[model samples]
Target: MSSVIGKRCVCRVEVSRVEWNFLHPWQRTPQSKSTGTAFVIEGKKLLTNAHVVRSATDIRIRPHGSTRRYPAEVLYFGPDFDLALLKIKGEQEEIDFFAENGKDHICSSGKEPDAKRKKFLHGLQFATDLPALHESVHVVGFPTGGNTICVTEGVVSRIDFLGFSKSLMLTIQIDAAINPGNSGGPALNSEGLVTGVAFSTKSHKKNQPLSNIGYLIPIDIVKNFLGRCQENPSTYALSPIIPYRFHSLENKSLRLAHAVPDTVEGVLLTSVCDSMKGFLAKGDVLTGIDDRKVSNDGQVQLRGDETIQHGYLLRGKFLDEQVRFSVFRNGEHVISSPAVLRYIPTICPRWESVDYFPDYLILGTVVLLPMSTYLQCQKGCGTRLSASTTNWCQKWPHEWEGKEGLVVLTEMFSHEVCFGYNRPYWRFVETYNDIPIKCLAHLRDLWEESMEQAKESDDRNGDSNSAKTFSFVRLGLEHSDDIVFEVRAAIQAQADILKQQHIPCPSNITQSNPRYKS
Candidate 1:
């Protein structure tokens, strides 16, 4: 309790709009407002989560005691770290009031003190070394209702190998009471040092009682954020690849899409950074890298020639430099190619651009604009039901066979239109109203047409018809029944039970959808 009582720190945050694709036919562009905390770091810089400022067209920050919000500027951000450095004048003066005085010794320094009172500062320090299992800790954050910071004490219950992100730090865990408003808050050790920043929460079992299991983005990632801030402030590392010799593509046509290599494939030149020495080359048909076998499809796998899938390879490649490749060209096997590490942004092909989706929603479903990469990722396996098409067929490599758009990652039931079909992260949108969805333009056109039809029905029926009308939605499939059924059903049952009691419903339904398509 002592760790919590004094751990509270005041943070002033303002809401900003995050642009997302509208899955519906009626809505052309939609923006969601998200709140984020503003904290002073390194005197001149303000720190917040990259997500706080992601896709923001407008940004403002308010000091803890101020009524007038001041415009703030982003200095640097890294998608990998989910960390952003914001800039505003008078930052030092803004936080000077909370700075500890000379006589205020916040540190216990291992000395046993009175149990009744404990001291903490505005921001805690991260222990360079990780805490042991069951170690005591606390989290300080500015929770939802108001800006007054709150502290919740808990323990380091467990840590697991969560997959990596753009910044590529290994995943970690803590059992602190971190909620939606607690994100970007600091996790602290007994000494009041920051261990990590709260990012997400998880529940271990389905239909099971749960606790405050939170995931923190490790503090060590600050190094990468700092570097990007100084060198490339405009762009964050969206998806950086440390390239090895690409051997050959099983389907040379799908070389970019499949990223697979074969015995007869030509290597990609990738990047040529003069500063990066002894690590890369242009002609290496990569066979293996850092002991990971390089598949012909440009896939890096673990031992026994297993296929290393997803962005996980990006994680391993982040920590190491050189990779050994087994390349065969003209019947010659060469085991060499310096790894090339380069930052490559995720390109939303013009055809698949979010703008193409209908300005609104329809039939409680959102459609996906077919991008070359998305279709390529699909390997042209699923049937195309949407009516739209694109030039991606020409530009995208042959290996894709004719697929587009990466599978949907998530979907949240934000409003009434998506009530019963509130499935999130279930399946990718393959078609819309029987139309073969090809590109963003196609999806958009389909949505507009659907909206017109819905409007016409409303005029004839003399009913508002607004309840079922949708705005643009990010298209994705529903979670697998087995994966989401228990939790969703429990939530539904709970809602019904609460309705019987005349009690208000929970504002936010906290659940993680695990069934994500590629």
Candidate 2:
């Protein structure tokens, strides 16, 4: 175990800084330094945790024992997976190090390396197959900025779903002691091959200290992620199709006026990729796939397998594969075949000067910040009415009842629309244009209509100098000051209506609510 600890590990990474505000409203204090790690598989590219470089103003990667540091930048990121790819300049020393110790080299050197090539290969190669559960493992990285690479020894505790990232095969649970500085570091099997990237840990509660429950991003997923990056550097940042955010819509009793029982029961196709068009369109209620009947809740029941989400059944397959969807469109049950797309549509996390808010456009802009049981654990606090305003765009806990209300997490600023409205974190939006808002597709239509009206108004007024504005009607506890009664009554009325309609709602809300069952 000691021999497997640090000898074969070489992670390409940097030191990063993150800032969180404890006091002082709306102000991010200063930079807090944290260790970051990245490693290459198959010489394609690098991998690290999304949190490792989150909101980082500076990033500098240096080899374990080297004084020289190289500037690195983000290549791609899947927030849902908590993984990011980094692009760095290949210097002589770095290339030599990678050639010697990293995964099997795929890059062509201008000149051939003779058997006696003097490359200073520093990293260990990744193993081809996954290690069995309970296999001994070692982790290596510069945690807390020490003189040399720090190493921790443990064993794989679990190797199924981690229920964190939406990407398939993205996580691994280990008893290895992962610390704040150990994030993005490489986890190694006893054979000295890289296995996973260390990411998160369970927190200690009162009277209950946490144990070795560290999680890792499996090397296999990273390998797949890197391959995509290397193949297309320009679009490497784009993610594959897999959604982290999805709400159940198997309402049999609350069917639309003409929607049939089958249409009412299957999962509602609430949203699709913003960039990925033609593959999936919003409002297409998926009733079945590949000839299998999708349960009303958007799940596909297999012969003896556990009922799984239809999307999960489509996991790991490529775009262009013919997927038959039995969808209920406009009260008609139709089989729609959407083309497979490699690129996932997403709102770039980094804000851009644009007209559409990403998720809100797909789901309705009217939403409540998720106040589920899972959200509360992250914020380390209980639900308070005013907390949403202060923590807008900042991480906080939220609580809620079943289908409850829609919560807004992020909003894109497009033109002058929604200009005066402050983005509130964890705030719930109940309606749009007086209609009960449920998801992203509903919001997109509302926004489009508003834009059209604004355009018409401007045209009729012949005012070229003035820009028309659209109002984003939102109902929530945040506006409890002005529309307190209205929001409360709406909540109660909605609850009663849903109960009367026999619509199934979530039993409890938590950050873990949307997470996949491990």
Candidate 3:
């Protein structure tokens, strides 16, 4: 197939972004410029990798060989699958964007091809089915070498692969020349139909990055994502989560502990998903799912000969779908039943939140907010979370005591009341005034109650030695001593502390605040 079709539908994405600074929630990181690729899709929309436009402030799209740069906006972004759907900011029913009429596309010559001899592609079409191993493919994008659309040929080296966030998505591995600027481009097959989207490669790895080994969001997952996106435009539409977390029963000792026999070949349940509430337990060993036998290494055969992780078998399963499982529980071969799939989130919240602005709380010189998954996502985005606390933020969904979050004292500064106490930076606030602190909202409530008590109980009292006259708040922490401060002094310094720090408000207790919904 000619590269002309690719040049017609594909585009050069120019993004300028001012990324957020997790440590300094009030400020954004410096602006930066990057280029990638995208292709025209249905309904006047474009599709590209989510990371390409992440935190983007200004976005422009330049069609191949064209001087016009059209402004675009993100319609929907899916960080889990590394995809984003975009639409031109202006121009409704603008057919000229993809026009083949007297337009010089990809050809440097200032002449358009003869009308009867030319062809135009309205949009890139999905391949009817995925390509096979050793199938030749083309990668079209504006990579680092030059701005022109570069086409590289490669073969489908492997299939049914997974990457990033342990996403368990069906991916494609190719031996292609994928570079920095090639991200978000289309991977087309022999018939010029897009088989996948070139999203990432191994060259960005820290230790020993290599070239010629790139990955693609296979058509299977691509179609699945688009199918859901079509149901609800401009929303982070999601399918139901794979309803199980299994650990390999490869260790004989571990298997014996679960009272499993040598004849049994299955994976141990690290934690049962809440979606399967009463049907399964944490210690139960899963022998099979959907009637397919799982090996001790937690693999199941798919597509006849292809063997993939047990989780892959659950891919693309949407809401209300029944998942039958064969289980081993309580020293017997029991617990075989099906459970309906539901949208249950992991213990940690997803990073693709609609809330772009993070919430913050200021108490005197100390700054606080709830710990979130951002601690993990932005690898180099600096934060004060300790190693153990950071690890706990990555847990799967499970039953836990108390509330579901940790109120972290992220920042501490010099102040009269904060002088003698140990700096409680990044430590979980376990209690306030002998009352358990559940979340930032709860902490705000307790602060209000403490202030009301001070005003009514002791502002008029003459005896400073009375217990009621002790206007101080004690905050207990995990693995640290209590942080005690005089409530009156903190209140007096609150205005100055906030003013000097340039903080917007004393407390933005929830991420769901409509003010930060954008």
Tell me, what's the RMSD of every candidate?
A: 14.6, 14.0, 4.4
Alpha-carbon lDDT, every model: 0.47, 0.51, 0.73
The candidates, ranked best first by TM-score, are: 3, 2, 1
Clashes of each: 66, 34, 0
lDDT of 1 by residue, 1-518 (tens): 24442343324556556443333222225566667665544444566777667667677765444445666776665555567777653666344434421124333585533433333333333467655567777676667776666678787765443543323354457767666667666677787666667776665575442576777775655544565455544444333443322334455575644343343443443433332344344444445445555455555433243333323444434323344444443346666555555543222332122212212211222222223334324433233311122322222222233443332322343333345654334244544444455434455555446556655655666654444443232333322331112222333443554454343422211121221100
Q: Which stretches of candidate 1 lie over 4 Å from their true place?
A: 1-10, 18-21, 24-33, 57-70, 89-126, 145-147, 163-169, 203-209, 239-337, 343-368, 371-398, 401-518
Instruction: Name model 2 segments beyond 4 Å from true.
Output: 1-29, 40-45, 89-123, 165-169, 204-209, 237-518
**Residue range 1-518, candidate 3, lDDT tens digits:** 38555566788999999876666666677999999999887566789998899889999988887877888888777666788888888664245665631254545675655543344454677887878889999999889988888999999998764756436577889999788889899998998888999988864558665778989988777777677676654344555666666789999788777778898888888866666777777888888887788899988876667777777666666556688878887767764566777766543455634433365667767777666634543453244455645566445446434666667676687777677766435677789988887677788888877777777766567456555556788888776788777887777677778788786777765455231111
Best model per lDDT: 3
* Candidate 1, position 307, lDDT: 38
Model 3 ranges with Cα > 4 A deviation = 100-120, 203-208, 256-263, 328-338, 355-357, 373-387, 394-398, 422-424, 455-468, 510-518
Better of 1 and 3 by TM-score: 3
Model 2 — TM-score against the truth? Answer: 0.52
| Candidate number of the best TM-score | 3
